[model samples]
Target: MPHSLLWSLVLAVHIISIALWIGGIFYAVAILRPSLGLLDATQRTSIMLQTMSRFFKGLTHAIPTALISGWLLILHEGGFANAPWTVNAMQAFGIIMAGLFARLYFGPFQKVRRAIRPQASAFDSIRTQMLIIMALGFLAILSACLSHPFV
Candidate 1:
């Protein structure tokens, strides 16, 4: 394939992956969490733990794709310093997101996954992390929306 087509494919995958990841988080945090409060703590925690496990299983691809595609886009366009505000903002957002992913991948996410028995502490931790991740993800989305790459 031509270079432009190749880049387009990468970009397409990257954008879709981000949409899924960020959109899922928004839905969970903005919609699901509040609704979940109706249930008792045990049920809520159990369900959230299981739900997050599944969600992360599906979302495992999003971060990696974003990283790879963003890198390629950067190299193709040159580097962060040379890119427009939109690209630069996206790169910054991506870095923040990468850090969040690392924490999720290496930290509480593991413990939460292990809590198949619905531990409240585990659930609380997972909820807190999800909030943080959701906030950062929303910021990234907002940045992307507001930024004008050509400007």
Candidate 2:
């Protein structure tokens, strides 16, 4: 395949993975979370765990796809030194987002998964971490759009 075509394909995958990650966070934080208050504590906890589990499973795949494709796209564009400032900013945000995810997953998320009955504080911690990750993701998207005028 032509280099340009391969770059385009990788870019498409990167964008799609970003969409899934950010879109899932948007849905969970903005929509589902608010509605979750309608349920009783036990039911709410169960539903929240199940919903987050599904989303996180997708993340296990989507995050790596985004990172790998993004690196490939960067390499195709002549490496980090040749990339625009916005691209570098996006990469920095992406790395931060990934680190936040790792912390959330190993910390509050694991606690929630293991507890016989998860506490409100545990859930709150997860929500807080997710909010930070989502904010970084949005910033990364903005940087990407700024880097590429056509976006």
TM-score of each: 0.79, 0.95
Model 2, which residues run further than 4 Å from truth? none
- Model 1: runs farther than 4 Å from truth? 40-42, 149-151
Candidate 2 lDDT by residue in tens digits, 62-109: 998999899888888899889999999999999899888888888789
Candidate 2 clashes between residue pairs 3 or more apart in a chain or in different chains: none
TM-score of predicted model 2? 0.95
Cα error, candidate 1, residue 151 (Å): 8.1
lDDT of 1 by residue, 60-98 (tens): 777888878878888887776687786677777777877
lDDT of each: 0.76, 0.91
